[model samples]
Target chain A: MGGPGNAKIEVVLVDDDALVTRTLSFLFAGEDAFSVQLFNDPVAALRHLEQHPAHVVVADYLMPGMDGLQFLSKVRELHPESSRIVLTGYADKDAAIRAINEVGLYHFLEKPWRNEELLLVLRRAGERALLLAELARRTEDMAAFREKLFRALL
Target chain B: MTDAPGIPDPCRALFSAHADPAAVLDPARTIREQNAAARASFGEAAGRPCWAVHFGRETPCPPCRAGEVLQEGNALRWMMERADPAGPAAPPGVWEVTLVPVRDAAGRVTHLVELLRDVTLTLGLERHLIELARGLDLEIARRTAEAEQLAGRARELQAAIEQLREEQADLLRTERMAALGRIVAGVAHEIHTPLGAILSSLELVRARLAAGRTDGLNELIDLLQEASERIRKVVQTLRAFSRLDAAPVERVDLREGIESSLALLAHEMHPRVAVERAYGPLPKVRCRPDEVNQVFLNILRNGVQAIRGQGTITVRSFAEGGVAVIEIENTGPEIPEEDRERIFEAGFTTKPRGEGTGWGLAICRRIVREHGGEIEARSAPGRGATFRITLPIEGPL
Candidate 1:
């Protein structure tokens, strides 16, 4: 269930396991504000996002084609405003830290995750995206105002 | 205000009297006067444009501070390279220049006075000092690299010397073992023939006494015969030990060596302890019979000493791959893991100081290695210990 109204936050889930993807999709489907898109192939997910950007991206750390960090870096290059989260079976603290530091990851979830925790994190990420969108709009308005004042004075 | 400032009137006199190279020029870029020192320093062309006479250039230099002073009506001081015709064909000489503005009575700029002094020698000395510093840095680097190389060579030499010392120790051990073997073989061979004769004569005397029906004499003769046979067996064991050095290469039966070792230690074995042999059909391995028996004896003795009460020592042997394997397991307190690796090293023993010299295992390891073999021990804390020896079948007998 996305939402009753027209405003809905799109979330893209990228993992190599189909069962994991299905389980996460079902869990997110229970939320009203989220519309989940599942992709087992990271490359396909990246290609889909190039055409249709998502509000948030949740990826697996280990994948066949590309790893979670590499995928996040590519996603950041394509859409710098997208929030990225990594879900992994192994809790490699060093890799997680590196991923967060290098690629600007939003959060990380270890395997055997609870549905409530995943939903909570996604909700927080959606709220952050909303705040960033608002900030961007405000910056644009300020720039326009500054330009008009400069023209009148010059 | 009617008179020109600081230097116009007084500098003309100062310039003529100065010993160092000097020049005076007005703001219009024309040289007004040259001192004797300047004439000697720059040669001809005394009264021309300052740029042409000093720089050998027909045009004023770009962003010229001298020109800026004329336009802005301010004083300026800078250094420039002036062409020196009387000097060697090196680069131009360095000159310190000072510009001063002259005002008229109505407070208006009238003319500019410029004074020049040569400073080429000082700059040349500074360059020489920089070059000397660079040379010193290279020399220090070269010495440091040489010292490092020398240290590396010393380390290599130390390693080679240690290897040579180890080889010398091994050669000495081999020589001692070889000499002991020859001496034992000679003594055993000398005793064997006479002991055999004594045993035969004792048997003859016992036969005669039993036939003649002498009861007391028969018992004495029987005791003598048994003692003679015991001596003969001792001689046989000694001979076997001696033959280890000269034994020809052959596929030796390990079961025989183990049996002979047991027989040699039979008198020392306690009645409370039982010795068991679980031997398989092992292929004949190329080895020295006496040396292998010595290895078995040393391990068996260690096992017997380890057990204070009733215990069992099992000697097992089998062939696998291209090697012969023998395992001697004892039912006693196991060796600590920390001591297992160290027990095989030289001068390591658990026995009381005088009871054992700590050379038994060291010798055993040497002999085993000489035959291209390896021996290792395994033990748990509370369980018993096991020593396994694996010998390459293709090694020397």
Candidate 2:
């Protein structure tokens, strides 16, 4: 995606099937408002997040080696501010319930998903990520202000 | 008195020798002579008065034909029913009496002959015949009453059959309308998905055209064709599923009915409900497949309506007790205890006014019962509701 502003929203999408992510990437690529990264391997996506964390992480639930639930659980621990969404062909109620309660999933969209539904969920996640980032920045500013006030008292 | 005749003594002897129960009486009503038969019947009256010997009366009997004949100088005959002193068990008998006047050659009444004849057996047979005729009258009356009762029962059975036919016709109409409503909703939802994709692709095409770009036109046309094809198939499938034909009753797999119904409901149900199947091996059911599938659709709709939000629906089919049983369980609101009894009754609805006419379950029950099958709802007040339908594999009972 091309954008003149360097402060655009960053989104990372991971799925075992490369075709799904490739087709889905075009939906975000058409917009100048987002910088979307696609990966077929969850480990590679996880490594990238360690160095440079994204605001929203998308995953498939029925992946090999590491499922969407486990991967999102790790994402929750690594970057609490990022919003997690699972997109998969398998639609199991128990699995959906577990994902919501244990992994703190934001949305569960079944495959053959419509473009509007995906856009609606990703837009909501982006708003939440922006709110959390602003809150974290204010906390850092408050901590630095407190350190300065202690030095002045000394 | 035996020799008081103006004629000879030989006439008196001939009168006494008569074999009939006869006796000779003088004008003063005294017995002159009696034949042997008369002595045997009246206890050997030789010189006693006629009344004293035959009737054992102190006075002359009233309506005496003997005195009348003596006055008229003619013979007389009389009939009467009287009890016989001879046989106690014998019924009352009729007696024919004759009073004959004996005259001399000088036109003078000499004697009166009283003939005694026993006619008890003839009277007994006549009485028996009358009694038999009365009995025959009563038997005819009883048979007529039985025939009337049978005719009344036949009329009632005919009325009951007519009522069942009317109810069946009403159920068919209501189910078809309900099915149409559901299929319409599904069609709307299914067509919306592809329409959304087509609209989004058109937006891309418009943007590319403004940028003077034609590289992705082929892919865009392909997407449009694919989406339009989806719309066509959805319409075609709905047409096939809803085609109305003559009722073709046959043996078919029970699972096929369930699957077809689920496919019709997939567009509406997949997003809202998670359906679980635990189907066991079941025998082919003898039924009209289209009607049975309609029942399946109604039951699924019932479960969906009960659930508030997201719910689980479990469907199971198996053979039990020479019947094919299909059970559908819903994680929705439980039906109350009082409602279960009248749930299948016509026009009985638990849903609010416009949302439900209360015909779905009733129609389902009717269809099942007409196929020699039964449908029942089992649920605790809050544990959720399950509908079980059992159908015979042979035919309608």
Candidate 3:
């Protein structure tokens, strides 16, 4: 839960089926702690991601043109700090796990997923994304402070 | 001397008392003397050549035993066959002839005594025994040939039984594969999509109720109803399709079976191929609905695959003349003219290796034929390929 001072967790959901994306969008609704965007086309989603940064990206494994792995890999290149998750309808869990490891994705989810579990995973990924951003800001501030000290000593 | 005059003085009584037809021949083969029995059989043949008297020949009888006896200076015997000299109607007779060489005191062969006898009866019995043995040998050969023929038939029957066992095993395996193929395709898209929708929709309703807010409750309930209905229809179709083997026979609406098959294959057709159904009034056909459903699945799947990217599949059904008919047509590349009929042959495939078993169309034809139906393929160069199936309403006899 987020209060007025807390920032909303930004998320993007991608799937070829409009119904699936729509259903996922509803799952994140009425929650002040999360902000969700949906796409039925991986290419279109990639275009949107180039202009706007999302903290967490969730994609379906089976899409017509570009699959989840390819799309998530592209997302990684665009934003390394963003958490990438894959959703698969396949019955084989081993395959899903292998895909996650092969692509260095954040997590793997199955279709017809329990809502509570899905939310928990997405929340954790969002937290990680916020932590990485905060660490990068701290490192930049520390470097600037050290540069100032070196100038003063000279 | 008292019996006959001019006999040799050394053995005169012994030569005259011999009972068998006997004669004495000089070294030149001239008959020198004849005993009483010899004279009775030959009728004063003491001066005639012996071969002329017995065999009525111009030359000495071949292999003359008396001649050999004289040349070798030893006793010899032989069998001879000739016509009976008594009359023309008398049966041919055989004889055993013997020649005895007599030597003087100086060891010179002075004469040879020739002996003969009638042996026709003995030879006739021997010949009859040989004929009976030959007949028995022929009978044994015939019985051996008959036994071999029976064994050949037994071997053929055993081979037929082995072939039947193999075919039954193949049927069981292929049936399981068909079921698995349906499950994979349906589960991936049709049921899972609706299930995902239902689960999330229920969660939203539960959260709202827990929060004591009834604002969007009716809309969520509506979503739940729609999603569940779709799942129910898919489940019903699957259950009916799989239960066909247990039922054995059923009077079913042909259109409904075709619709169920289409439902199972809906995932393959979406977002790429367009499906058009031109169903007409059809009569209920008595058949094994499950097997018939498989036929539809094979054809529809084939239709989906034949299209390279985007195309239309048209399915038509109707009844005419107590026969239900279905025509499935695809707007894709036409099948080659030569492969129209051969596509239904077992082990015939156009797909790449490991992608096709070549049994799909073959099995389809078999199932259709088992229900007293006919299946055929037609294709023109530009129009595309069409499969036409017709089933008799009365069922197989």
Give the candidate number with the greatest TM-score. Answer: 3
Q: What's the lDDT for all of these models?
A: 0.69, 0.75, 0.79
Q: Candidates' DockQ values?
A: 0.00, 0.03, 0.28
Which portions of model 1 show Cα errors greater than 4 Å? A1-154, B1-215, B244-248, B270-272
| Residue-wise C-alpha lDDT for candidate 3, range B257-301, written one tens digit per residue | 778777776655666678899999988899888788888888988
Total residue pair clashes for candidate 2? 0
Model 3: runs farther than 4 Å from truth? A1-19, A30-37, A41-109, A119-154, B1-161, B184-189, B211-219, B239-247, B352-355
Among all windows of ten consecutive residues in candidate 2 chain B, which has the lowest summed lDDT?
B83-92
Q: TM-score for every candidate vs. truth?
A: 0.43, 0.51, 0.62
lDDT of 2 by residue, B219-249 (tens): 7767767777877877765654543442487
Best candidate, DockQ: 3
Q: What is the TM-score of chain A alone in each candidate?
A: 0.90, 0.88, 0.91
How many residue pairs clash in model 3?
Answer: 0
* Candidate 1: clashing residue pairs, number: 1
lDDT at B330, model 2: 93
Docking class of 2: incorrect
